[model samples]
Target: MARPHDAPSARELVAAVREFLERDVLGGLEGRARFHGLVAVNVLGMVERELDLGPAHERAHAERLAALGFDGDAALAAALREGRLDDRFAEVKAALEDAVRDKLAVADPSRAG
Candidate 1:
């Protein structure tokens, strides 16, 4: 389906700025300035990835939570802390790992791999 916006959506705009910073601004900077520019580029890249992956991640997270018999993270955490899921430790661990993987996929794709 088409996005409910005109050309140059948020993700595209962020990517453009990131590319410009990397290609034009970073090249002319030094020391702290260059480091900050690179940081900005990395942040924008994460934003782009989040925009692309957030929906699917949300769905997967919900499914994982459901499989663990919880409705949300808060509930899951509470259950874990209360030892309610002790008997299902392996299953819970797997679900949490999948959740973390999904989060990392958007927050830091390189590390996620």
Candidate 2:
């Protein structure tokens, strides 16, 4: 999902670098350095997941919001604050939870489950 100038693909490039860091860079280290390397690898994994899931997540979020008759989170929040949605709080809660779960799915699928 890159433009013509993107060669090996963004996800591929990030994955390759993550692999290198996990294997080569972390292999030689210990203590805090290793911990930091692990964190870096985790960050890279998040980046790759974001690249992979961000688009679909956006689309799903927009569709969900449209179905709920809200423009976005701010509009939904305003409605909640004003008690405009009090009659349908259960439906609102389910939709909000689903939205959060979807976000968590992209940010960390394991934790999302």
Candidate 3:
């Protein structure tokens, strides 16, 4: 038994549209239309990934910032620019790398590696 609202979650809807674009629409599109269609599909894929990964990523980012003794990105950036984190450069670098990897995971899994 499935309720109408319970079926086809937002992520599922995005996936369905992305699949349709990739499988049906892309083949029929040509020239600039095809290019735009591909772009739309890519954006939809990013949205799907964000829906799947955003919450976990948000938590991890906050944790990383806390572990680095910062409240937010602006604070962290200010500290770095002030050379306050120079002694802890390696730790900062690792945290930043992890952050970038997480972003890439949502933006483009292939590039996340």
Could you say which candidate leads in TM-score? 1
Instruction: Please give the TM-score that candidate 2 achieves against the real structure.
Output: 0.89
Candidate 3 C-alpha lDDT tens digits along 1-41:
66568768999999999999999889998999999999999
Name the best candidate (by lDDT).
3
In the range 12-62, model 1's lDDT, one tens digit per residue, is 999999999988899899999989998999999989999999999999889
Off by over 4 Å in 1: none
Q: Which stretches in model 2 have alpha-carbon errors above 4 Å?
A: none
TM, every model: 0.94, 0.89, 0.92
In model 3, which residue pairs have backbone atoms overlapping below 3 Å?
none
Cα lDDT of model 2 by residue, 1-113, tens digit: 54886578889999999999998899898999999999999899989988998899889888888878998989988988999989987878888888898778867789787
What lDDT would each prediction earn against the true structure?
0.90, 0.88, 0.95
Error of 1 at 78 (Å): 0.7
- Clashing pairs for model 1 are none
Error of 2 at 76 (Å): 1.2
For residue 62, model 3's alpha carbon misses the true position, in angstroms, by 0.6
Please say which candidate is ahead in lDDT: 2 or 3.
Answer: 3
